[model samples]
Target: MSVLVYTENWDGKFKKLSFELVSYAGKLAEMLGTTVTAVSIGSVDQAELQKLGNYGAQKILHVTGPNLDKLDNQVFSSMIVQAASKEDASVVLLSNNNSGKAIAPRISVKLNAGLVSAVIKLPVSLNPFTVVKKVFSGKAFTNVVIKTDTRVLTLSQNSFELIETGNKATIENFNPEIDTGLFKTSVKDVEKVTGKILLTDAEIVVSGGRGMKSPDNWGPIEELADILGAATACSRPVSDEGWRPHGEHTGQTGKIIAPDLYIACGISGAIQHLAGISSSKYIVAINTDKDAPIFEAADYGIVGDALKVLPELIEAVKEVKSS
Candidate 1:
């Protein structure tokens, strides 16, 4: 039995989630008494795949071509299926991010495998493998057993603990045949967010909401984030009002984050917003309205105006960092 993890890259470099997924796949490999292999398809070089040894991948299979750079559902799913077939992978892992969400199900259909998305916990085996996962928009969890030839899983970001033990492995390059006709999507300009990490993968998040009053009032939020080495996020209303980018929005309809600490400033917690961040390890809520629903989900709640509270928080964070 072999476990294969699909690694995504950016600008010919391995993304952070690549190691995370490979580390998770290594655990599955240990359980199955097999080796962990990684499959990467993009413009990345074989050297990038070779570096996956740091994450315990025994072998890396890379397929690169001009058509592989852009996201083509048909071409990517086909290539992944080909890799799984070649590797004879029993369990296939992918990160439950944008790319994973799009490709995992398609690959599952191609492989006729059972899939578990948003996987939180590792497999529990009494007899068959039982994987626990979030369901109903993270309202509850259910255990699923993959009683099939292949088990496909997409691990949720920040769900599993990343383990590091230096193990450098060999990387092999294999080029797959891509029918240029199948490449429907074209590579265009890529836009990137600057000065902040993605909230989903961030360890700490400093979020602002309507309490900031205006976009200009977000200075303290950025300062606090910089001091704490955290990402900046916003509530739905703030994004709707165009005070912040939509990508920084965190709510049910927005990005869900499970950071170690989530500090919500000036945002009255609505059920919609709480649904996105309720999985965070610890929550700190600050608002002038004591009755705000956000306080219910917070580990610590402070009833005060955000305009007054933010400056103090920023100053305190800077002081601690300097000390």
Candidate 2:
């Protein structure tokens, strides 16, 4: 039995998320007494492909072709299924991000594999392929046992450690025979949000809510984020009210992020918001409302107006850095 991990790339480069998945797959492969095969779908450079070997991929499959750069859900899923079949991979792992969420179910159906998503840990038992993942909106975890011979798992972001190994992986150019008719979609226009830290990839996040009063008050939030090199986020209401961009929204209906440190200023922690950020290692809540729900989830709490508190917080951070 071999392990297959899908290493997603951006602009022909691998991100920390890919390394994290490889690390998880590599450790799992070790536990199962097997090797790991890393699969790359798009145009990734040889140098970038070699990096997966440092994370314990014994073999790397680089699949690139015409129209493959643009994501066609059906084609992408098909490619993974084919790779797993060729590699005889018993376990498949991918990030529980947008692509994984969309394609994992399809891969499961094609492989007839049991799928467990949002998995935070390695398997509990290799016999039945039991895995653990957060359920009930990250409030609790459940151990799911995959009864099938093959299993597909989606690892939560920032859930695992990136471990480098000495293994130098052999890279193979994989070109699968596919009917061009499957390319039902064409590239229209591509727009990217540039010059800002991506929320999902940020280790620290500074978020604010309507209590900042208006969009004008967001300068302090941005200043603090810049000082700490953190990503700026906001509660749903703040985004909906146009105080912040919708892309910065974090909650049940928005982006789910697990940062090392999450600071919520002027935000009341509704369960919806907590559902997105509850996995943070440390939470700091600053709100004037003593009974704000955010306090319950915070590792540290400060009861004060956010507008007054942010400046002091920024200054403290600067002083600490200077010291």
Candidate 3:
């Protein structure tokens, strides 16, 4: 038996998230004294498929087929289950991103295995199958134990460090026997957001809230983000107020991101908003109220009007960069 990791690619290229998942799986497999197998679906090149080896994938399975560009839950789960069976995988690992969240449950049912999401670290113990994850809005930790023989886990983004093993993976063109009749819908074309840093993959993020006063005042936040080469995000209310797009909203009910640095400007740090960004490595808060809930969670905080403070912050960043 081995550890199998499912990797996702964007436009025939693997994202850092895919590498992180493989790296986590590799470390886990090492702890268990097993090999690591990575599965990639789509039209990823052989050279691109081999990149998983840098993170410790001993074997890479590349699957290609018609209409593979579109993601089908049944097709994805079936392929993953079939790949796991071929590898006799004792554990299955994937990213805790949108696609992973959608397919992990179905794979668990197919394998009759216990599943865990947002796993932060390698298993603490193997005997009881113990894993760690944050709970209560990242204020508390919980140890979960899976009793099933086969296990499925979704690794939280940015929670684990990446490692290169300097070993090359054996790439094999994998063809899983799946029912073609499962393809009920066909996507004729795709539209992708270009020239923008995806919040999920961004290491640094700059977020604004209603405290910015109006969408017109978002200039400083965008400038800060551009200077830092970071993604831009917004609190839920900002989106609801039509000050920002819904895609940029981040909270318990919106996208969950764990970037290296999260700068919150004019945000009150509501519990719902904190839940999504609580896993960030460092948090910086700027608000007029020193007692704002955002300050309590921030590594660095500036108590002032965001409109007044943002310009200074932008200039400071520019100076640092110029220096």
Off by over 4 Å in 2: none
Candidate 1 local lDDT, 222-285, one digit each (tens): 8888878899999999999999999899989999989999999999988889889988999999
Candidate 2's TM-score reads 0.97
Each prediction's total of clashing residue pairs, residues at least 3 apart in sequence or on different chains, is: 0, 0, 0
In model 2, how large is the Cα lDDT of residue 66? 76
Candidate 3 lDDT: 0.93
**Candidates' C-alpha lDDT:** 0.86, 0.93, 0.93
In candidate 3, list every pair of residues with a backbone clash.
none
lDDT of 2: 0.93
